[model samples]
Target: MADTRERDIIHAFVELSNELVDGYDIVDLLSGWTTNCAQLLDVAAAGLLLADGRDVLHVVAASSERTHDLEVFQLQRHQGPCLDCFNTGVAVNVPNLEVEAHRWPDFVRIARSKGFASVHAVPMRLQGTTLGAFGLFGDTPGSLNEDDLALAQALIHVASVAIINERAASDRDVINAQLQHALTGRIVLEQAKGVLANEGNLEMQDAFAVLRRYARDHQRKLTVLADQVVNREVSGQEILRHARFTSIRP
Candidate 1:
């Protein structure tokens, strides 16, 4: 199991590195990242929050719907482990939600109600600036072991580098613009997901998969494709047809 886990982590890093090439989609990259963290780490679910140019946090990706809603709740209340981690540029670990109720009353209550017993959040920082945070949720009350925590931090650091390295590190304006573009793309992606889900009578996850697969098969930027879907420039049925054909190809 340990060997398999090691291979999985290495494979994940290699895939991430490959996706960091020119014209990669930030929204798609981070969405897959949250999924990888949930699968590789000893966690029930994972979520990511990214800051816009204004430094306001937005839910960018999540491994599960419950995790996504939890992250949104945190942003709404403005008090949670993730928010604290982002603000302080450090990790916040809640081994037991019951113990942290006093510290994050609303967040703890909601998290427990959603069947999460513990949570940890690590900052995605480059240099002295924090761009976002990555969150891990566990169903039982316990801390992530030191190795898991270190691995999570390392993954987040790599993701930060991918985002910043898209533009020159010294160009603050370009960095902010890039981050802001990603945040905007996330909104469009959500809209496209909804459109596809309704059109195909599919679940949101399935809808996202179809969208991403079509984007990759066509070598189109995910955000640009999402915009076309949302604006009705590209019909959902067209994407669904391509997805169906792709799935059955010999």
Candidate 2:
């Protein structure tokens, strides 16, 4: 079991490295990163929050709808592990949410109501600059072991680097532009997901998977493809065709 997990971790890193190539879609990359982190770390779910040019946090990606809503709730209330981690540039490990009620009352209440018992948030920082945070949610109360914690931080660090290196620019203006672009792309991607879901009579997650599969198969940037779908430049029927064929493949 341990060896298999080790292989999975290695494979995750390799896939991340491959996606770091020139002109990769930042939103798609981060979405996949959150999903990979949840699976690799054995967490129930994971979410990623990124700061825009104004340093305001936005929910960029999540492994589950419940996780996404929890991340947004933190931003709305301005208190939570991910928010605190982003502000302080330090990890916030809550092995048990019940124990942190006083620290983040609203966040803890909503998270527990959503079936999450613990959360660990790590900063996506490089050097002295903090970008955002990656949050892991568990269904039961317990801390990630030392090695797992280190691995989580490592993954967050790599993701931060990927964001910075996406355009090979280190200037504050360039970085902020990249971040803003990604956030905007996420909005369009969500609209595209709605379109696919309605057109194909599929769930939101499955619609997103179809969008991703179509994007990857056609060697198209996810954000760009989403934009086309939103603009009607790419017909929903064309995308549904791919989705239906893929689903029925033996």
Q: What tens digits encode model 2's per-residue C-alpha lDDT throughout 20-119?
A: 8655898899999999999999999999999999999999999987898899999999999999999998889999999999999999999999999999
Q: Rate the local accuracy (lDDT) of all candidates.
A: 0.89, 0.90
* lDDT of candidate 1 over 203-233, digit per residue (tens): 8878888998899889998999999999999
Candidate 2 Cα misplacement greater than 4 A, ranges: 166-170, 248-250
Highest TM-score against the true fold, candidate: 2
The reply for model 1, stretches above 4 Å from the true place, is 245-250
Model 2: per-residue Cα lDDT at residue 93: 91
TM-score of each: 0.93, 0.94
Minimal lDDT window, size 10, model 1: 166-175
| RMSD to the hidden true structure, all candidates | 2.4, 2.0
